[model samples]
Target: MEEPVRWGVLATGKIAESFARELREVPGARLVAVGSRTQASADRFAAAYGGRPHGTYRALVEDPEVEVVYVATPHALHLEDTRMALEAGKHVLCEKPLTLNLSEAETLVALASTRGLFLMEAMWMACHPVVRAVADGLRSGRFGAPRQLHADLGFVVQVPPEHRLRDPALGAGALLDMGVYPLTLADLLLGPATEVRATAVLDERGVDVDVAVAARHGEAVSVSTASMTSASPRTASLATDTGRIDLPGDFHHPAYAVWTPVGGEPERIDPPEPVLGSGLGNEAAEVGRCVREGLGESPWVPHARSLRVMQLMDDVRRQIGVRYGADAAGVAT
Candidate 1:
């Protein structure tokens, strides 16, 4: 049997904890180490998740036993954290929105390519079984030609002003945090976006709290909305020439989808394989497969696709007047 892929998790935040829990469910994967700014935080995570705890990210990435590193820091820290792991000669799976802007994302991708190491954006939704099946069906003409799509995700964020979700320095915003999901879902089901237009409501700090986006992907049009100040259905639906498909609430990691033919009754479509855990583990499984197969990037979450999404978010941010530190440093918005 193939040896399990050894893993190290950097950071001990809520997302990191969630990934740790899901990582446990991925076959051929093992949690070897976890790192945090403080020893207490690392120890706590390790104790709960079964890993060796390191007080510093540097230590965790340098752990000889760790073959792949999962960068679970906030969006603002992804570039640096992922770059560090790549420089240390470890494969990486970084959290979504990849980086603050397209330039930073390019830098990381170039680095990974130069080093010939595996690098992938942790867009868990893209690895979801239900999503893949639906996208495949759409592409294969089993669902007919996709015409239009609409997806929305939102929640009233109840956190202090200093919290990451409300802080500009931390790359906090509804668009980056919640909006990426809807946009990605549309891209997968519709194709690469060719034109994008957006509008948003920003907080006092100039961080977007609510955002709505419309884009044209080939001949199909898609609308996506995300908000941090209100609750939404968090649903997605795709209209095609012959039928329609809908994903209920929490569409990003749905267990199943509903499909209705033009003149046929609605049918439920389940994923081809069992979901690992809360859907996140499926991405872990993808990483393990790629690493063992000596592939530098996951075909399911290609580098080009991740960069395209980042570019779209950049355009949206520019139009909405939400700027990050990278933008000020002359990074293309």
Candidate 2:
């Protein structure tokens, strides 16, 4: 049997905890360490997830036993934390919206390439079996040429003003946090967006609380919506020449989808494998497979695809008048 891939988690936030917990369900992956800004936070995470705890991210990456680092820091810290791990000679699976903007994402990708180390944005949706199956069918014409698509994700965010979801310094906005899902889904089903236009409702602090986007992807068109002030259906649908596919639940992490041909009854399609622990474990499993194969990036979530999505988000944010600290500092592209 292959040895388990040793893992380290950077940050002690909810996402980090979710990743750590789901890592357990991934075969050939083991949590080895966790790091947080404070010892108490790291210790608390370790106590629940079973890993050596470090007070600093530096210590976590420097741990000799850690083979891969899951950078779970907020959007603003992804570039710094992922860079730290890469520089420390560890592979990385950084969370989505890999950095505050496109320029920062390019820097990290370049660094990883220079070091010949594995680095993937943790865009778990791309690794989902159901999504992959659907995308393959669409690409292969099993679903015919996709014509129009729509996806939405939203929730009533009740956090304080200083919360990460409401802080511009942290790259907080409905577009980045929630809109990326629909955009990515469109990319997977249709293609790279050729044009994107957006409008948003900004909060008192100038953070976008709601956003709607219209994009053209080659011959296909798509609409994506995201919000922090309301709860949307969190659903997605694709209309093609021959049929339609619908994800009736949280499309980003869907368990199943319904397919209906132009003149046929709807058919339920399930993921090829059991969704292990909130489906987050699927990405961890992909990382383990890629690392074992000595790959620098997963074909499922390639560097180019990630960069393209980042560029799309950049366009959307620019149109919506949402700017992060990185944008203000001229670090965004």
For model 1, name the residue pairs that clash.
Answer: none
Clashes by residue pair, model 2: none
List candidate 2 segments past 4 Å from native. Answer: 329-333
Task: Give the C-alpha lDDT of model 1.
Answer: 0.93
Q: C-alpha displacement of 24 in model 2, angstroms?
A: 0.9
Alpha-carbon error at 106 in model 2, in Å?
0.3
Candidate 2: Cα lDDT at 241: 87
- Flag regions of model 1 displaced more than 4 Å: none
Model 2 Cα lDDT, one tens digit per residue, 76-166? 9898899999999999999988887899999999999999999999989998888988988887778888999999999999998788998
lDDT of each candidate versus the true structure: 0.93, 0.91
